[model samples]
Target: MLIGEVARHSGVSARMLRHYDALGLVRPTGRTVGGYREYSAEDVRRVFHVESLRSLGLSLKQIGRALQDPGFTPSALVSDLIRWTEDRLERERELLERLRAIDASAPTGWRDVLRIVELMQGLDSASAARRQQAVLARSEGVPAPADVLAGAVLAESDPHVAGALRWALARSDGDGMATLAAGARSEDADIRRRAVLAIAEMPETPGAAAMLADALRDADTRVRGHAALALGRRGVTAAVPVLVGMVVEGSNDVEAAEVLGTLARDHGCADRVVSALVAELDAPTADSATRICLTQALFELSVATAREVLRRLASDDDRAVALVASAFVGELDGRSAGDRGARVRSASGRRKPRR
Candidate 1:
């Protein structure tokens, strides 16, 4: 076959075939009377083989050596190719993430696109301060898109930067916070912890409450703890049990107790909160420290049950717990005296004076 016929059959352009010949990669083993390049059957087969290697990302120089050097081992070259391909794939993935971030910004033109890209770079910066400023610095008070913030919130490892990212997300329209729900379910516990923390701050998102509700059951203590605290602060009664557990565990138990008190404003939910705390105090496994924490948690409740429990605990066997309970009793008494004084003054003022 002539070069033209070989080019047509092999889909390798004629010029490329000539270049291959010059490179000694696939020189045709024939020539016509006119001195035009001619290809034998074996030469055509070599052309296809070169093209196949090229498809596998082999350089022309590498292809030349592989086809010509009988001593060349493919193992080392194949390993190099694998590493190169992986690096290329990783670069492509980063580029794709950058593009997606820009697209999610919903930029009106190239300027907005550049700004978003710059912010993304800042978020990825090695400096934690730069990353925080990236999330906080507004383009004339226009925050980064919530979706962009959501992505950063999940990827950020620095506690300060992560807090900034979450604040940015919370300040946005909150619609994009939906993207964080997937992170909440991530197999990585750290990611799930981050997701729950971010989601906890975005309770206004459409399903934010339900997402948090689901997170309350997460196996991670931090995940469940954050979820419960957020839910309890929002007056969600379902968080009562987890909040109570957090009190026993002393994991942000003070905040948990405060939230429980907030949830306890509802008479029905108040009973459950009080009962759960009292039960933990009564558990045989409850040590003195746990009892003290529980006693403090009881002080958060407004119900007579909690105060009565505190009074009983004020005389309990453990001196430390008894002292904390006794202090709460005194504090409660002080509050009662203040309340009575305020009421008497108001009633005295309401009365018709001598005038």
Candidate 2:
């Protein structure tokens, strides 16, 4: 086949074919007697492979090396490409986070605006111009036509803007929550916090559970507290055990108590949590707040088991326990003749049988 035929079959321009030949990357099978380049079907296939690799962001040199190695597999090459893409995306995320922090800390200013405009101009030459344009246009007060022209310029020249746009698309339209969850493991506190918040706002999917659980154990008390609150808001019942553990064993008992209260009310896990709380009360080191929280959770439980647990706690020697137990007795007094008599007997036992 002639060079034109190879170009047509491979979807590579004739000029690129000549360039490939010049670079000794993919030589034609033979030359015609009249000195025109001639390529075989094998050459056309090689050209397609080259184009595919190029599309995957491989350099011509890299493609040439892969072509020379018979052991190279597309899967291995794609694995390398994926690693490269992820690294690039990580860097882009870091940059965007920095930009967000800067935006949040300082009032918008001419210098910042100039810097953003310059960044946009740099991206105008990349594949993500249209997306960057859309993001810029959404900001307040930039007229539509000016935003378009500015975005076009940024898309053409700025690699960062292009990379950011690519990352945004991959994040928003693809597995963004998964990516953000991975980010949550970063040693940086800000990254972890941002990752948690980002994942919390994402569409609720089953995959999000593990991340929320991790956030519940985060070293930052505020982050852990927020994660628990968010999970409760989502009514993620699967998180009940973790939330209960936080209530029972948290370093910040007040925060844990508040989160547990919210979980009891919002996530419908009051029964399970009340049971854990009652068990905690029997442990000698339990704090007054834990006892109070337990009693409150029992009230929320409003079940036969709750009544039994409260009666047991009320019989304890601790005054705080007695007070909460008395409240539980009063609340249960009107339920039924059997329940009322049982509570009266339990209260009589706690009062030394009124001797």
Candidate 3:
């Protein structure tokens, strides 16, 4: 067969076939009468073989070694190829993500695109300060896209930077909410923790309650605790059990207690909150510290609802518990009925500022 015939059949261009011949990768077995590069059957087969290897991301040098070196390790060669392909794929994916972020931002001109590119580089920078500045820097109408902010927020380890990113994400037209919701469901506990924390601050967010409700069931205590606190603030009853659990576990139990007290303000929710607290207190599993925390938490509830529970806790076995519970009872005893109601109302209504 002639080189033209082989090129036509093998789909390798003639120029490439000549280049392959020059590299000694595939040499024709004979010459035609016209002196055109001639290819015998074996040579044509070698050409196909080289092209096949090329399809697996092999360089010409690697393909030549694969075909010619008797000692070359095929498995090692394929492993390297796999690694290279994977690396290329990762780079391409990152590029695609940046492109998507830019497209999502809907930039109006080159300046917007450039600003976004600068922000993206800063977000991915090694310096936490640079990352912080990236999130805090004004875009002058070219807002950093929400997905970009969301990704930065999830990966951010610095507390101040993460707070800045969360604030930026919240203010970014709410597009980042979906990214945050997905992060809440991530298998990575750290990510879920950060996600729920960010979502917790978004009570004004439309679907944040549903995400928080799901997070209440997370295996990580921090994740679920954050979700419960966020949900409780929204007045969602679904957070009651988790909030009660937070109180029992002593995980931010004070904040948890305040939220519970907030929920307990509703007459219907009041009994349920008081009952869950009572159950934990009565359980032998609760240690002195757990009982004490539970007592403090219960104190957040209205005196009308938890007064009886308080009276029972006053004479409890633990001296600390008795002291704390006795102190709570004494304080209520000194209040007029209206003053007692006002006291509970005061505790539940005050909220620490969310980032």
* Tens digit of per-residue lDDT, candidate 3, span 137-168: 85758887989988887888899999998888
- Candidate-wise lDDT, in order: 0.86, 0.64, 0.87
Q: In candidate 3, how many Å is residue 158 off?
A: 2.2
Ranking by TM-score: 1, 3, 2
Q: Choose 1 or 3, whichever is better by TM-score.
A: 1
Mark the 10 consecutive residues where model 2 has the least summed lDDT: 142-151
Structural RMSD, model 3: 7.2
Query: Model 1, 196: alpha-carbon shift in Å?
Result: 1.4
| lDDT tens digits by residue: candidate 2, 221-241 | 656755776686676665565
Candidate 3 error regions (>4 Å): 337-355
| Angstrom error at residue 51, model 2 | 35
Where does candidate 1 stray beyond 4 Å?
141-143, 353-355
Clashes of each: 0, 15, 0
Best by TM-score: 1
Per-residue lDDT, model 3, residue 50, is: 97
Best by lDDT: 3
